[model samples]
Target chain A: MESGQHMLRTGRRGTLFEFSMALRDLVTSYHRRGLAWSLAWHDVVSRYRGSILGPFWITISMGLMVLGIGLLYAKLFGISVAEFMPYVAMGIVFFGLMAGTINEGCDTFVQASSMLSQTSLPMFTFIWRTVLRNLINLAHHAVIIVAVIIFFGLWRVMDVLPALGGLLLTIVNLAWIAMLAAIASARFRDIPQFVMSVMQFAIFMTPVFWKPDAFPDRHAFLTLNPFYHMLTTIRAPLLGQEADGLSYIILAIMAVLGWALTFSVFAITRRRIVHFL
Target chain B: MTDVSIKVTDLTLRFPVYGVDAKSLKKNLARVTVGGRLGASTTGATEVTALSHLNLNLRAGDRLGLIGHNGSGKTTLLRALSGAYEPDEGQIEVRGRIAALLDLSLGIDPSATGVDNIRLRGRIAGMSSKEIEDKMDEIAEFSGLGPFLAMPMKTYSAGMQARLAFAVATAVEADVLLMDEWISVGDADFQKLAHRRLLNLVERAGILVLSSHDAGLLRLYCNKVMRLEGGVASEVKDIRRLDELLAAA
Candidate 1:
């Protein structure tokens, strides 16, 4: 409930005031994170409501994908299944989370258009909803990661901490990207299609299937791909190897720079987003 | 909780009507090379002035009615007052918890049960879990959905859906309640219940801003009335003079 003063003024705001207001909105939405979690859970449950397997079906399909692609690519590359199964399984899972979050982020505002137009609900609520819902899907797909890692007998219990940290960092990075995509796509309807195509092309280019070790000479190009760094933050840690310092450095820089850019755009356009929708 | 107020100074809101051309990147990219004469008509988003330089103030115990012809900014003014739209020129300052019944069906999810939707709406209204739980039965009772509350909302008729939404919306006991129109939902019996419930909600409210076409309804609830003509508002006149104002219009 709004217990204090609420003010809305026209035209440009002082940078400090605008950013402070935007930061306040983020904080307010954070307090309402429970609502977002519930909505995201509802989104997942309701989508698969009457089905027997329900959301588990997503895991099943993802399981099939990792197995199919992991085995096929392992044979094609002449690598042992043990060497490749865990890598591809995790790549698909983590990449799915990243792309799905960014893709669905295109709908952040558009999906909440009804509530946004009629109520004073914080705009960030829907962005978190989109991110959380995709995160839930990632959870379903995580079963594949667990089964693959255990089948290959690949991880130490201590390795779980770093992998969890990597997962958290990856989610933080995707959150800003999703917010930006949602903001842009709310006004430009074609942005979603464009995003979908870009992500599709990105899957092949980001080494989700092929390992970077397979082409050691081209390692410099991998560093240039932000998705590769994001993937490494999670995949490398889970495989019991240290992510290159550059990958974590690049990820930290991306998180900081991406959030800064997203916040600026969001602060300036927060109010006008309704009109765009 | 008692000192509720709303003040708008020279508030103006313009809606940018985005055409398909303006929304499409493909067409815009195509027009970069062929973009000279088309600039004025093709990709430019047409702006419609929804509310222009409107000013209003209401304090505790004030119930103001908004009357206007269709597309004369009635809904737009309510939306701006609700903080759903930003003022394009002026400022809107409000003190109180606001419950805007601008769109009854705005948050209803058909796939969810009626009971679940009440929770969803409650969450949207910024209610905590305990508060929503406490109000759930009361809202369900007021909606008169009874056993149907457990069933998915999709099975309910449009009127039934409206009933659930209205019940949950009005349950908030808002300090400032902004309503688009008098809700007429369900059978004659439910309408009576809804009207009584709304009257009670408005009675407890510190300030009420209702926009409606029904003069009778306005006279019953509002102490003052204002007419909007093409995004411009007339003076806030006393409710007793509504007939004279209507006749003059």
Candidate 2:
């Protein structure tokens, strides 16, 4: 009887360890594949579920913004419609993606509080889903990019390959930033408001409407801004211009560091986040 | 030896409830952090102890019932047992996969239909989408939700919602079933069905711990009943154990 009691005690301890490790394992495993296209596609479909036009709403809204800004800003910066159109188009697409992903990620847990507190799933799934959903929105805006180039009659076929490379980099960069922001926003309630304010500031600061050359001597300051590098790399390639290797390197380093920091913070605070909620 | 199913020694949990703002609490915590009492004023204030040096042990086949008043640490103990809250002092060792059902309303997406929500909930429970798909019909039939399964979960009534949620949870087998309260089924028919299902569940589990205010209902289901009085446990001998006195009459 005494030996049996000891064995029972041992089994209970094993169960406790198993329960604790189960959650940890769930999180690491989910992050392995990140977000898949199918899941993101579901989010996009669910977003405009009741709407008649569906995803065309994104296209129409983007087109009007580009037309209004491209016409006004082209004259303000002394650039022709031909040059301004592609810049504004690429700017709107990339910025909209960055803004949407970062802004939405802020409330990643707050929005999913009902789900997380009760369900035993890894928290990272929600973060990746938010990022993927916004990427779908980005895909919708790509139509505007194609349309703008065609309308301006500056459609160089060679720009396609370089544009593809720039888009790939933009996606990688946005993924890292979104992961970092999602983790931070989940921890700090004020992050979404802060991200929105930054986005409002970045729109004017980024060279979306005008050329970097228009800024002349102060152009170096534009290079210093991370958004500036992101904007130029994505937009420059679309405009059939060479992208700076140094800018790509800097952005890549930021992406790597951002991921490391975000994952570490997420891992440490994973258990405690539910308490704050 | 069979191994210890649960061992909690001197476990204590304190939850800080600040009045209005954390500023006052912040100062008190800072003092305590630097090896000082939280001043006389703060010390004189009311502090509720959720759990005080809780010590518990359970072995296989122990279907224990927790009885206490509103603040008598039943829910706190359940959370601690499930690893949701870490004890302030002492360690807990549990030996099986605990399927905790404090709130069945979690993981249901408002926008998703019952089917979609099932997939999401199943995924959360580590079920692949395909696995959820295979069990989807079984869950739907078991829930008895019928045509309403296609509608969004938001449209379902509270009881209907609970049925779906409970059905999905029961689909996954559990070694240790921790129920907050005996789940309330919708109607007489549903209640009968739920009773049958619950009995089936109780047979497979190694240990079952349920917290409820209805001592009579607990006596019906649980083998041992322990009451939490003044932050300490006092086991209540089974009333049926007094059979000799009753039989003499």
DockQ of each: 0.66, 0.20
Q: Each candidate's interface RMSD, rounded to one decimal?
A: 1.9, 7.6
> Which segments of candidate 2 are over 4 A away from where they belong?
A1-45, A75-78, A149-188, A216-220, B1-49, B52-61, B81-83, B86-98, B226-249
Give a tens-digit lDDT track for model 1, residues B30-85.
Answer: 77878565656653578899888888988888889999899999999888888788
Query: Per-residue error at A259 for model 2, in Å?
Result: 3.5
Model 1 interface DockQ:
0.66
Please report the candidate that would top DockQ against the real structure.
1
User: Any idea what lDDT model 2 has?
Assistant: 0.67
lDDT, candidate 2, A115-182, per-residue tens: 55543345667767777788778778889987877877657633666556666666677766775666
Encode model 1's per-residue lDDT on A66-104: one tens digit a residue. 889889989999999987999999998899998999999
Instruction: Judge the docking of candidate 1 as incorrect, acceptable, medium or high.
Output: medium
Reference-based lDDT, each prediction: 0.83, 0.67
